[model samples]
Target chain A: MTIDWNAFTPWSALAGGALIGLASALLLLANGRIAGISGILGGLLARQAGETSWRLAFTVGLLAIPSLWLLFAQLPPIHIEAGYPVLVAAGLLVGIGTRYGSGCTSGHGVCGLSRLSPRSLVATLCFMGAGFATVFAVRHLLGA
Target chain B: MNKTTITAFAAGLVFGLGLLLSGMANPEKVLAFLDLAGNWDPSLALVMAGAIAVGLPVFTWAKGRQKSLLDEPLKIPTSNDIDRPLVVGSLLFGAGWGLAGFCPGPAVVATGAGELKAVVFTLAMLVGMTAFQALQRQPQPA
Candidate 1:
């Protein structure tokens, strides 16, 4: 397969990855919590008392930060190749799958792997393998 | 807000910024990375490596601590059993990710950016999660 040399941004990717690592680390050190997005958001739906505040605060911060960044740097252009129906289907799968799996890229891929959790490794491999397979199927076989 | 809340908020901000800078928020970029057959972009691999590099040391240090800085009991997941749900669920999540190139974190962040598609996707995801919770609460046929 050909590599997209023009679109590649290794430095930015590395820098951003470092920031994510720092964020998860800080959360663990200070709050004693895993920075798993699904867990954080899911907790809000369950509405457990004493847990609501931190989850809400984190959600607010997540939403607010990017908006604030627009004042300084223009966000890169967004292009979604899927239609509304596809997006909806994909979103549903992600939400339910993350909850059932108990983690996502952040929880399992970032935090779990960092701690060398075997479960996270399996989950990461499963999801990543599935991701690769799906892309291959959709873009190649189905040609969507 | 208390220190705990402030810290959580700060962590979220940093996480969001990381997503933006890493181009994870951009579906095209993510899709390109996922595309193994044509025009593959390995930039995301570097992102993961960078994150793991920093994370390995911190997690090691955290493991030695009994309590967090806020005096809360450290709550790391201790489950080692790889069950069917974990594998099936992850497979589904990955397929969805490949289909749309948007995961939970990026979708939520995209919604905040007021992308109409993101808003729709977020709503659908919440509905999906709610459905899962609802179904999970239902009695199983014996």
Candidate 2:
């Protein structure tokens, strides 16, 4: 019930979100593709000719941007309380789930919702509900 | 590189920067937002709202176009039916997100920062994705 006002950074968050939206908009306007991280990454695995280049280019950009940002600003400190086993399990779940679900937060939550896609809405709700339930179970019931 | 490739690269760069600036690259920030029972941070809500606000109009414009600016056919998904795979997959993805507080985009961006945990998580996620692909190739029991 308590809000962490001290940790809250709405301005930056909003700015970043706007940047994300801008990125998606640009991609759609330029390439007509959804900025879905999973779909982009998954396509790389397929190794389809003519498709691999752009995916690789996009991923390389994703990897390179943060490194580039370090020159201008200090990257935020990362904190992960979960152990390696839990992290691996969670990673696996996310990978499989995003593939099966057809998209993740970016594709479904941002782009899909923006386009008013009902499937994206359902997918977003399910994932968000699951996130809430999982957090509640882990933090409250299991005390982990 | 071609214009399409250049565009993809630019989009990825912007997206990565957005993720970093939004505090999403920090797992603690994400976990705090998800921790509705404990100390919840609503910053992510603002992030989503801001993204949607800008995206809505753009998508509206894009919907009417048959082709991108690059002259390629627009490939937007048209399926609206909420199927079992969609629900189950989203549920599982949400659980993983809650458990680790690192979705695919942030995880990849974090890996770029040379975080060992992100490296491990990314590897595991690739393994999981590969496994899903293998599963899809198997024949269903009749």
Candidate 3:
């Protein structure tokens, strides 16, 4: 598949990042929540009283965002390098990891770290380091 | 909704918009960048830079304030110790990312990006998350 490198726009990334920062900031200003996915999903799973509504709403919005995008622009193509089995296994592993880690990237990297959480600092570094190592191993070492 | 939930929803919305604007929502673009041996796309780096640029200032502003706008104090994770769970979780997350070009945010965005596969991947992701919770809740042999 051919890609148009020259057409790549940094502004999109800037706008995207700005949007995230704004949303997170606004949420904090308006609601005082950290916007962590693990906590939200975990809350839903544990069925904590009175937590279900918001969790469901959050999950719904998560699903809705992409659908809204489709109205204006064409969605990109998807090519999974791994097979179904690998993908499923990978998903399970991530799910377990989030439970053990206490938060996902957004929770740690975006909200927690922004708030100066030491635990998030450690978690973020660990995950990012592991990510770099994994990419190296998969694409370089294993050649998979 | 409680403060936390409201914050999460708002954050998700902004995050979704960011992913869409940045092209991070598109898994194909991510894969192409990962296809560094062939045609490398460095656009994600710019996204990271932009996030850091914006994030740093906002955090600084928040810090200067006496208290968080939403509560008495900011909630920060206190633990700094690196433990087994930390190591394992990072490894697992990394492996998943390596196998799938998209992470949670991108995957969520991709669903809106119009890829049925992303929708499938996301549903599978949710199932995987739920299944893990179930397993953890099961009684262990003592």
lDDT score, candidate 2, position A140: 90
Where does model 3 exceed 4 Å of error? A1-8, A76-81, B1-10, B31-39, B60-75, B112-114, B138-142
Give per-model TM-scores.
Answer: 0.97, 0.98, 0.79
* Sort by DockQ, top down from the best: 2, 1, 3
| Model 1 collision count | 0
The DockQ scores of all candidates, in the order shown, are: 0.85, 0.86, 0.44
Off by over 4 Å in 1: B140-142
Specify the highest-DockQ model's number.
2
Query: By the DockQ metric, which is better: model 2 or model 3?
Result: 2
Model 3 alpha-carbon miss at residue B52, Å: 3.4
Tens-digit lDDT track for model 2 on B1-142? 7999999999999999999999888888888888899999989988888899999999998888899999977889989788999999999999999999999999999999888899898888888888898899799989
For model 2, report DockQ.
Answer: 0.86
lDDT of 3 at A67: 70
Ranking by lDDT: 2, 1, 3
**lDDT digits (tens) for residues B57-139 of candidate 3:** 67656655545665545543557777777767756765666566666767766665566667666667677677778887899
User: By TM-score, is 2 or 3 better?
Assistant: 2
